[model samples]
Target chain A: MENIIELKNLRKVYRIGEEKVIALDDVSLSIKKGEFCCLLGTSGSGKSTMLNLMAGLEKPTKGTIRIKGQAIEKMSEKKLAKFRQEHLGFVFQSYNLLPMLTALENVSMPLTFKGLSKSVRDKKARDMLKAVGLETHIKHKPSQMSGGQQQRVGIARAFVAMPEIVFADEPTGNLDSRTTKEVMGLITEMARENNQTLVIVTHDLEIAGYADRIVHILDGNIEKIDIINARRVSNEEADNIISGADAVPAGV
Target chain B: MNKRDIIRLAFKNFMRRKTRSILTILGVLIGTSAIVVMLSLGIGMNESFRRQLSSMGSLNVIDVNPWYFIEDGRGGGYSGQNVLDDKAVAKIAAIEGVEAVTPFLQTGLRLVSGKYVMYANIMGVDPNALEAFGYKTAKGRMLTEDDTTALLFGSNTPYDFYNPRARNNYGGGYVYFGGYMGDGVERPEPDVDVLNDKLVLTFDFSYGERRPGGTGGSEGGNKKPKLYKVKGVGILEESQDERAYSIFMNIEYLKKIMKENERAQGSMGPRPGGSQQEGYSQVKVKVTDMNNVQKVQDQIKEMGYGAYSLTDVLKSMQETSATMQAVLGGIGAISLFVAAIGITNTMVMSIYERTREIGVMKVLGCMLGDIRNLFLIEAAIIGFFGGLLGLGFSYGASALLNRFAGGLFGGGYYYGPSQDSIVSLIPAWLALLALGFATLVGIISGFMPARRAMKLSALEAIKTE
Candidate 1:
């Protein structure tokens, strides 16, 4: 209903040995509050780049990108770090859980960055993992867990802090079709329960089936945008919903 | 993240590579022990010098001797008057920093018992000043003002007595001057028990001289030469001091004996002045503090006496020991420098390996300063533990050195055979300072590596394998 993330004329250019390559063409986009959106593109079409830019992980060459009406691109590194900690979470394509940490530790990492006490962050992370059906695997390290389980931990980490936005890039790119549907369902369900904005970047058409809107990007430019009501379109999808996700409280 | 969490994460990362961490810590250990032991040697030398010099004579005591008819060795090119007599002793006593002043008077006398006679220095001194002069008896009480008839024998004073007839027959190689026979012959034991024997002192220098084969009698031997009955009140411990091979008595009593003996002879004395008019042989000034010894000596010298103290020798000895310590410390510093380089190298290698981990931490909103603090704390912990262990090693080394390292330098590093000789000393301050310095070295060594970690671009670091 309300615009939580706004991008006006976003452009990103990279210099490769004497050639100027445009990684992201002039693109104007806005993500709404509580919307589960998908940025769909081929390998070189800048979907991951878009995710990175929105998460404040990379500086854009030209654009005014604002989150909650504050210009993120213009902020200094120190301020951006604090801003990201308080407002954003990230899930990478490879799951990117620190291999040395257990699943519970990985899930609690976002709350840890927010400087919560260990016990407090741990409790929230445990509840988030239970919501994703990984309660029994809390102490399992990333190397010991399956792809689906690690993505569940990743999803738990991204939402445990109850941030205003979550940027997930190819979150299911390394999982199988069965695991892909399960992870995507867990991620969108958790986001929908909290009414938090979720932005996912992927090349798979099936992954877009769970999104409220699908944005198609071709050659660093948005080709089209499709709005869908997946909840209303499929009653069977509701059965596959994460068991305890809808009970997630919307905390201030 | 909180400070504690950042530090905990850094420590966990350090523990990831156990062997590398241990090796780095070992380097710091060797470096710390090296410096501590090297510095302790200089401190040991200084302490040893103090003990040795003090045993010979109190370092704070100055000797002021009269430059009499014999010119002082100072070679002033123009002779000055010897003013360090009884009057000058009072002047010196009034000088600032002089704790006490005592005059020393020595005259030759013959000690006799039955058939044994010995020529000994009859040292006369004020009984009150004996304690200040550090003179203590090993067997009996020291001479006092009322003990005018008493005498204190030096430990070796009995050795000066011998039969001149037996010595002339012996072939005079070892000088059997202690009433002894030649080789393979039983020497004559002291015929007098000094404490209980009838001790007599005669001021006549030739009292023991006898004609070679003439019935063992000198010119005045038949008359007994007015024997003065004295009591042996004390026997002093043997020392490398002016009192060695001498006998002590009250100064006024010795002067009275000499004056009365000359009156009985009624002959012309050797010098212009009578024995009663003779001045003190030397003056001793005790100082309150060792640091003030040189000052007191200088003032005494300006007053025109040949003055000296142990500080003159101590100053040169300390200088030599300081140079020796510097060279040794330099050698130790080179080792520590190598260790510092090892720390930097280890940190650099750690950074290269943990690039992705650091990137993950940064992306998770850990502050750049926190990342820097983490690495520094890790390096410093290594230094702290190494320093603590190194100090333990140095203490062990010091104990072993003092116990078994004695007698290496002509009996001992001490002046005499002393049990408290120290070859290496690590004072408390040195140990504490070494610990702090080692930690500082670790922090400084980690500085550049930490900066590199802080400057790493999060985006590129995460993209690294």
Candidate 2:
């Protein structure tokens, strides 16, 4: 497997008026193509910061970050925007689908940036919503949908543009346990079906159980890299686990 | 993103707050109508001037005369120096704004029928340039170049003829002629029909004779007159002008008759006197514009000839009208300025509300230029619709003026040959300019808000609500 994302000595410092706090301290990591990776840490442990850095959402204070051989740390704002539009997709924790837009319109947003005809983008969006099993909720706005359903729309939007990497920043943070399990299953299943790279940031052990590799962080530094070698859970098995059949069966 | 997407997104954004958009558009509407109506008043006044001048003569026609003296204080009474001859006529015709020039070779002649004879003022003109001079005949056709021996009778020309024996009491021009055929009944009409009359014309050298007290004698005991048998080709309608009392004829024919009379008199005519009646009495230069009339007249004056137009009175009237127009326009401009402020307020509020949307668009790969253009197009749409509706309001306002105030200016269509009724006038070009002006105001008012939208930080904007 080839590494599609590389981080070398990455550092980020935030200044709150005067006091400076280190968010990501010399973070170094690599994720292979088509691999599902998880950054697991508690609050203030910089898991979200690391995800943001890899996703080119913020500037790094020092060192280089590359994705698919393209420089992320040094890219200009305009070029980074193009990079994100062409190669990256994001699902925020709050299910950041525009409240004014319906599920299908939200899903087709990235494709709109791609300049596809309205009918073509709508067709693609319809297919993605159907894939997430939200075909009936396609015309419902984010405000009108349930947490699980809105997250499904977010996942659909993330993969609709066919990006190489999808960043999930605590994507199930607002959903219930049952919805969380279902949302995670849909995200990982979509990634595997498309052979796309997925990077999720979360503090949930159940959510981390779905990843192929879990990298743990503490106090802005990588604590350990845990490679999970276990049978992958299908959407049916994830449902069963939520129904009290068994847990994800973590291997230490 | 592509243009369609950007426009679609912008349109959707504009639709998000419908009331605000409608209010802003209404503000622009008020502004546009203000400017249009104010400017229309100015145009109406100008149209009135044109109509008033049209009744007198062409506003484009400037009359040139020889400047007889410098001033009373110095070098005065140097009269009859510059002859307004063929050379000066050519010179005036060569002027830049001069569309055409015709010399007035006026001769006082007597038209004699069998027993009735009348004295008339005969103005010589180039027959080919009659239509250009706006001369319209009421009876027969106007004199053309081929009508070398033709004459056009004025409405008053036939009425001026009287029996020489009966001419004594008809001095005031309203007395009965032909022995009062009957006092309680109608008087005998002129023996010759003006348009079909074959009248003998006798040139008297005292015609256009500038001599002091030179105009006294006509058909008297010590005179020998040269006669030419002439035919009347046309009759002019009555107008509030001197042309109503004058006869017009081909210039070359008048010149020939003048020269023959001079020869017949053998150095006893006005040509041999200090009066110098050999050249044209006056030249009328047709100008291209009423505004350029003064300039062209000044140019002719610089050539040492005196020039005048009704614009001398009209210029004063227009100067006063201009001040009124400016005041009117200023009032309208103040309203438009208030409307522009309203537009700016709306756009600024829009930016503040749409910060998150702008951030989302920026994150979605929309360019900064695209964002700026989107806001501009939104503002322009407001102006576009406002201008369209404002022009509609202006038309209604103008029609109301024409309906209620038509007699204050003109009787709707009583003025000659012009489309304007004069209460409120909006020329096509003024309407176009008002639309463009409203659009520009919208764009300018949107400038600051659009820049602020462009400067918003995308990361912070997204984090904000």
Candidate 3:
């Protein structure tokens, strides 16, 4: 399998008055194509910062980021925008969809910048909405939709352009347990169907369990990489483990 | 972005803010209409003056009169020979821009018809010298060589001259004295048809002989019973003096009458040495071109003559029109300035409201140029519609003014390039120019706001909640 994203000795630092706070320290990681990987960390463990750097939404203090073997950090602002649009998709925990746009319109936005005709974009966005079971609610604005439904629309938006990698930061953070299961299941199924590499950042162990590989971060460093394969745990078992259950199988 | 899309978006945006757009347009309309109305009035005034002056005489015609310079010691009595003669008339006609020249012979005479007698001035003219004298016959016809007995009367001819049967009380009832000849002879029993009929002249050389000069006052005087048949009455269309009435007759007839008088007195030895009429009393010259009237007048003045032309009237009219235009335009400009300020206020408010939208557009890949173009297009649309409305208002206003004030102002009050009315006219070019100027003002007013919108940082704009 080819590597879709690679980070080399990534470091990010912030200054607080007279003291320096390190957001990420000497972090190195790699994710293969079509892999559903999740960075699991508590608060202040540099999980969100890692996702932001990988998405090229912010410049890193020091480090190199390569997506599909092209250096993203070296690109100009204009070129970086194009690169972000073409190679990556983002789903935020708050479901940051544009308020002025309808569900379908929000999903079609990334494609609009791609120079597609209105008809073509509409058709593609509709197809994505149907895939997420949002065909009946395509015309509803984000404010009109429920939290779970809004996340579904966000999922549709992220995958509509068929980008190589999708970065989802706490995809189920704002949802109840049932809605969390629905949104997580939809995201996992869509990523697998499209053979896309999905990188999710979350503090919730149950959300992280949905990924094919879970990387645990402690004190701004990767502490463990657990691959769940063959004998995968059921969602209920993952929930139990996240709720601090005592025992679980090694692969599960 | 493509132009069509930009225009479509601009139109849509304009439609969204209908009230603001209309108010801006109204401002432009008032400015444009005021300019059109004011300029038309200026033009109309000029045209009215021109028509008034033209009716008085040929606007192109110049009048030249003889001027004599007497020696310092010479008393003013006929000190100089008549400078305007046939030779001088011919010379003036040969000048580069001279069109025609005519010499006039004028004298007052009394016509006696039976017991009815009336007095009038007579003008002796060569039939071929009409244009040079700027003569126009308003009634009857001008004299021709074959009609030797023809008499052209002026408009002011006494009523009895045309109606012979009409009663006359000039001398209390009726009294006859016959027509007076230059020599003071009165023939009794004169032809009664001479009131409105032709007279036949008879001359007998041996009828009257010169007596020896003595204190008995018997010096010989010429006498002739020459008659003239009233062929026609002519009305002079133009004259410098309204009260100085005159009539025209063939020069040949006058010469023949003089000769008969000489022969009747038995004083006809050898004919006078010079041509019958030695020189003209006054010569009037017409120039070939109206524009050259002044130049010709100047040349005549240099030749020691008094000259007058309508160019002075036209010049005064031009000056008045220019002054009127400036005053009127200044008034219109004040309104235009207010309209521009209105546009500025509207654009500034629009910029304030659309700041966040502008930022979103920038983030959506709209170039800085595109953002500026969007705002300018909106401003231009406002200016264009305003100008159109202004023109419409001006048209309505001018029409109402003409209808209500036309009579009070008089004819030619509303003079257009091709027609006359009470309301002034707005020409097509001026209307077009007004629209363009309004649009330019809008663009200028929108420029700073558009630049401010463009300079906004996208990140900052997006972060504005």
Return the TM-score for each candidate structure.
0.78, 0.84, 0.56
Q: How good is the docking of model 2, as DockQ? A: 0.39
Q: Score the docking of each candidate (DockQ).
A: 0.38, 0.39, 0.10
For model 1, residues B1-465, the per-residue Cα lDDT tens digits are 787777777777778788998898888889898999999988898888887787778888888776523345776455455744677888999989888888877778878766667776888788888888788888788988798989988765655665555645223222544333124585454445677778778865555556655544346344445779888888887576667668989988987887777777766463222253556657788998889999988888777778878899999989999998899888888888888998899999999988877787777777788888889987787777778888899899988877888656323543344667778999999999999988998899999999999888878766623
Ranking by DockQ: 2, 1, 3
The best candidate by lDDT is: 1
Model 3 Cα lDDT, one tens digit per residue, B1-465: 446445555676677668997888888888878887887777656666677666556676776666544445655533334466667777778878887776665544445443344444566667776645456776556666565656665544433232233443343222322222123454343233332454222233221222345322133454434444354545555343321256667766756665565565555552332224555555667787878888887777667666677778888878978898899988998898898888888887877776666654554445567667778887787788888788788778777766676555535422322234334666677778888888887888778877777677654554413
True contacts kept of each: 0.39, 0.32, 0.02
Report how far residue B119 has shifted in candidate 3, in Å: 7.3
- State which docking tier applies to candidate 1: acceptable
On the 0 to 100 scale, the lDDT of residue B7 in model 1 is 72
| Candidate 2 CAPRI level | acceptable
Better of 1 and 3 by TM-score: 1
TM-score pick, better of 2 and 3 = 2
Instruction: TM-score for candidate 1, please give it.
Output: 0.78
